[model samples]
Target: MKVYLRQAAMAAGLLATAGLAGCVSAGSVQDPMSQPATLVPETKTGVVLDQLPPPARKLDVAVYSFPDLTGQNKPGENFAEFSRAVTQGGSAILIDVLTKAGGGRWFDVVERNELQALLQERQIIQNTRTAALGDQAPGLPPLRFAGISLQGGIVGYDSNETTGGLGARYLGIGGGTQYRHDIVTVALRAVSIQTGRVIASVTTTKTLYSVAVSGGAFHFVAVDKLLEIESGFTRNHPPTLAVREAIQLAVHALILEGVQNGSWSFADKKAGDAFIRSLETEGRAVIPVDALEPIAAAKPVNPPS
Candidate 1:
């Protein structure tokens, strides 16, 4: 009986290993090392942002800072990591999006994120000219001022909001998959530089996902002989990329809201109106339910009267 059980376990282990090998081999068929560097592909939100209609007049905008307000560290097991959960160069990403908005026709972005560095360079130039010409030196041109200022940051990050896994083993052979879901939220507001009032504000959320698949086996192949094997792979959605997508979506929503509220207008009125109507279904809102009638309190039961 023991001999038969050992044989069964060994056979099961071999079958499990073979099945996992087949799956892994499919992707390994390609020569990954030969792949060349290429431009990063656009996300869905980025594609829509690039396709937006041009505004009647580009708004002069400035982004002084966009920070990660979620102070959470990278998640791990049985260890502490000092690295943050998201990227630190959020302002750069936001500026890049703004510069590319409406095919570079929606915003006239100014350099406010590095204002000190710009001023210093300008001062150096002014000094050099004054010293070289002895009083006939021309003054540097005034920097462009922005009429609209963008303010916002990564407001929330929830790690492992949902997690699940499943697995089965018969005679010491098994395969399983595990998945986890995370969430990131961003808030953006366009403020009128002169009036100090928020022109348009938007909050956007994105879900990040990670999945892992693995197989392993342990069995006795012969008398006093034991064999074991393991194989696995993990796929994790990039947190920074998730942040970027959230920001892009926020920008798209902000533009649409601006149009809806008359804060801005598209160059082609008919096209703009049509586009807005098409996207109306994508907009979301939350409404609190009001009870039609209040429930009456239950009368206290009289004690055995």
Candidate 2:
């Protein structure tokens, strides 16, 4: 009996050490609170947006608002919560995408989201100039007008669209992993400022994944003595980043749709046609992974005699 307990204690210690090593190697043990501020990491969709062909001429565009229409509350396992599931700064994300599209050669975005504040500031400048210089006061140049208005919003936030897990245990030592999937959708449209017409529109969707990994052991270290140890980590993909990717993809689609419908043109006809074909092929490859089916539980392992 003493020999059996000694062996079990050694096994538990080895299992615990291995779990700690795995977590550290995976780089999931660091505390993010200690990190310095950094620019948002670029996503796959953002990369494609940057690689798009230059437009024939930069279009003046305005994004007045991009509200969250879904009204989804953050999902919780135990209780209700008032916090929203998605970011409220959808307009800011859209504006940033427009400004960065095609390496800043696609669109000139105007400040329409805060038009009132801008106008007030301009008025203050004009009044000061008039008071100081009389009729010789130089006037502020006219505010640039937008030729096209971009309108859109985060339209959907579906939680727990897919969930699954797999686990195994042996000799009172084991590990398990679980994952959950969510989807976010965005829509964008370009409207002609003068014609009151929707020139182009596109909708895009992106998936968010949350995963957890855990390992633990329970063993008798000595007579009437027990040892228990657990190690694990959970990773949740930011919903805001998911929303940003969706918006970026929506912008990319809108640009392509515009080119196809003659609402816009590219700088080089041959290069543009080739680019369009390549992106269409890439678009079809963004299918979501299958994670809906629950994994079968692992059967217990018979202890060594």
Candidate 3:
């Protein structure tokens, strides 16, 4: 498998910078549609009402953190830079997609800054160890979140060249070339934050092209010519286009999972899918979920006595 070691490193760096305390604003409130029509279970007859996991007392959607891809070896400058760029771009894409799909108020995509502030106010840094045991853990809080999802990764490409000589070096001449392309795969995962269990995960790989050239003194000329040819292709097929496409695809997959799991409605699923499609087509990145009127908040249910 092709590896995007640098992209992974960049993702980690951006996550650190974004932190976990940003406050996402609810610009407008949207109306909540009626409960989803029931689904019939395969094993039974009558309709099965769509049941939501209990409404979380507090819903916090964490900004995704990419897995460390720095490996034992240090990454070079180009890889590091690419990794960071992709991570930031991917994270922004996920945030915008989720907010639009969840209708903003239904789910809170915690701004990194806001989350960081909350942690600081509570005096809880993720890496800090505490003396409290189990129930007494230092950062323990009763609030419950509906879910958390993370998405991102590195992207890469490669290519090659060859040489051949006429039998007995009859005016000795040699030449050959080949090209291969592939994009680094990115992963997206969704989990039930309260339970600390994954609900869904998806990985996508895109293609990138790379070409190599080789020969003799003539090889220099061939190499220079190849560079010009490749540069033209690269300029037209930039990594940003690939990253953006991957992000949109990943978000759409997540939305489908949310609907199937009862975390989101058909309406929400439709809206979310449409919004992302629009983003892909037009260059418009923002979706105004807050512009709609607020849906009535679900009343809390008491736990069984």
Candidate 4:
């Protein structure tokens, strides 16, 4: 009994020491337990979106819907809940992305997804004017027509695409880091309103990564008792940010393909580095390469014999 009591007391003392370490330490100005939200001058999307130049001519575009085709939910280790894996307001996010493409100079979007509500509001205004002044109130201007339609949805989501951990244990005292990766994919297409034909299509993907570094100790304090202690920090990439990045990449692809096919042209030539260098940063493709070689025009492999 005496030996067991001593072991219990020693474990308690070690835990108390750790608790004290977590408290305010020498020269510390703030509580160690609290952390503020990270502040940044600009969002990653804004920084990249701004790289595209304002277009010389904007196209009238309409969007009827952008739905989440991936019906997956947040994966749970214990019990699955009815929560979604991605944001429900995906259509709104897509709309904002369309507006920001080419720095708000690309698409003049018309609100057709809520066509009935818009019409009801317009009708109310028209009737109120008619009731107020008998007959002739120079009618409201006609609603603008769209020349193009943008459509698609979040098509795929994979959970735990990759997961790994590295750790070692000696006498039940150990530390390790574990990481997981998830992926999302989106597909977008533009259609010619007049012809009802698909004009351009593109797809993009974003990866979400999470990592945790943890150290823990477990020990037996008595014949029938055990003690355990653990501390760690985990970081997860925001899923919404992943969605935004995927959509942004799709938009970048659309603009470049359109320009290459002569669907539209940039107004300011000097300010179009962003559009010209799709998936590029600082004047080069974001692809990583160790070496490069310029190639001369290659001879035809073999003329069709």
Candidate 5:
């Protein structure tokens, strides 16, 4: 027993020492938020939007606001924290996603969230020209107007809607994995500015998954000596990402809905038909994980002249 005890202690000591090296090592990439950052969507809906073809003509769309309607806090071990369940800058995220859709081929979004600021800036520009060069100053371009208006906000945020774990133990040494699910819902609608009619509406939801893994060991090396060690890692999916995904899904739905009803069209007729056919097939709704070879094969190679 004493001999086995010494071995366990030595092994555990080695593992603990090795783990510490990660703390001081200079990694190839910096961890998230080590500096200023941007929101990136990584969901199936986002993937679909990226794969979809761009519209033949852009639509003028205005988003006045998309604030977080849910006032929930982050769940704590014993109590909730003050941190919000979703990002407060959801409007900005939505705009970014809209512009990025179809490789920046979706909508021409107007600036309406900060109307007063925009108006003030415009007034300053006009005043500056008049003050500097009298009446000969060049006139500023007119502000663009939206044909359709978008409305709604992040309607809901639910945390720990699902939670589970799996583990095993042998001779006081054990390992385990746990997972949790959170969801966010967003609602959006498009209304005609000229007729004041609601053209389309969509409600979409996204689920955030979190996973944690851990390993631990414990044993009695001697009658009076004992040893224990634990190591764990957790990866959390942000709720904001989920929100972005829901919005992307909604936009894709809107595009399909419009095209099907003749509300819009693609510049090329065959491109439109191919896109519609792809939408019908689930396989084409997203770009394949290894699509380079498949895409190359689909396109005929030109013979050398």
Candidate 6:
């Protein structure tokens, strides 16, 4: 009987060891590449606009293309969805400001249908011209555009924490606290279409916050229950309000830069600057002369008339 008992204990120990080994092996079999890698932090670099040459002449500008302004969400398992969202949000705000300030002079701001037709024609003409040039035809004129500028690009939403709480009674030891934080980042750029140069670029970050209970007992609760509590709390605090404000602030910065230079008018600049300052006490943006230099440099040494 003693021998039989010993044999049984040995078998149990062996089985336990095998089980642990199997688990480790399984974990090791997982592809490391399958997991998302940590992203590196972005370094802020000053734009060297001063290197550009002086503007030959401000051409009668038109909105050649506007960023995606519909705020339409892309549907798919691709980064394009996120990209579209940012692009649309930033574009909408930028266009509104530009239209109001443009005094109808800065850009043509063509309608969607008209813009599409023009683009199609431009493409066809470009193709024909290319072919003609390739064949050494006599009458092919080079394509000419007065100016081009990036109105805006991807401006992401901001995040913040709205509420937090602690519940010691839930756990046997110290109370647990719950916390929530919201985060968002937005990107925007202004470009000179004629020179194909980016005149201004801005990125903004916003943070919001909320806190709740934290404890080991909280983890033991049903997932659905925890989620329900979180949802109810979040319902009290929507995230977009702070984000919208942040976006407006960023837009204001870009407009201020445009106004400082002759690209945008002073009246619009004053109104925008005031609007931004009203939001925050110290809302100010200064564009160095150096920044504009690059735009000048990008122009052809002797552009065609």
Q: Pick the candidate with the highest TM-score.
A: 2
Per residue, candidate 4 scores C-alpha lDDT tens digits across 1-118 of 9999999999999999999877867546675655566742345655666567665577788889988899988888799868888877777878888877756877888998889999
Give Cα distance to truth, residue 148, candidate 6, Å: 4.7
lDDT of each: 0.80, 0.83, 0.43, 0.75, 0.76, 0.45
Going through the candidates in the order shown, the clash numbers are 0, 0, 22, 0, 1, 56
- The true-versus-predicted C-alpha distance at residue 59 of model 6, in Å, is 11
Residues 1-305 of candidate 1: C-alpha lDDT, one tens digit per residue: 99999999999999999987676654364534345668656898888788788886788888999999999899886899889988888899899888887788888889999999999999999999999997999998788988889999999999999999999888899999999999999999999887888888999999999999999999898989999999999999998889989998888888866665567767776665555555554643111112101101122221110
- Displacement of residue 55 (Cα, Å) in model 1 is 0.1
lDDT tens string, model 2, 93-166? 88998899999999999999999999999999999999999999999999998889889799999999999999
The better candidate by TM-score, 1 or 3, is 1
Cα lDDT tens digits, model 5, 1-305, are 99999999999999998886565454324533254556453777777687667666778888988889988777787975999878898888878878777777878899999989999999999999999999999999999999888888899888889999999999899999999998899988778888887777778788899999999999899999999999999999867677778888878777665554455555554565566566656553332324323332333222111
Q: 1 or 4, which is superior by lDDT?
A: 1
Better of 1 and 2 by lDDT: 2
Model number with the top lDDT: 2
Tens digits of per-residue lDDT, candidate 3, 1-305, equal 13687888889888876663233223323323324457322210000111112223324566655442322222242554333323335566556545543234334676662466676755654234453454445554644433565544443322111222231211334434445444545667777656767766666555545454444322235644622221112122344455545555555555445444445443343444454445436553232334222221322222111
Where model 5 places Cα greater than 4 Å from the true spot, the runs are 1-44, 283-305
Q: What is the model-wide C-alpha lDDT for candidate 3?
A: 0.43
lDDT of 6 by residue, 106-130 (tens): 3333333246786677778767877
Q: What is the overall TM-score of model 3 with all chains considered together?
A: 0.39
Each candidate: RMSD: 14.7, 15.9, 20.5, 9.8, 10.2, 16.5
Model 3 clash count equals 22
TM-score of candidate 2 versus the correct structure, residues matched by position:
0.81
Model 2 Cα shift for residue 186 (angstroms): 0.4
Worst 10 residues of 5 by lDDT: 296-305
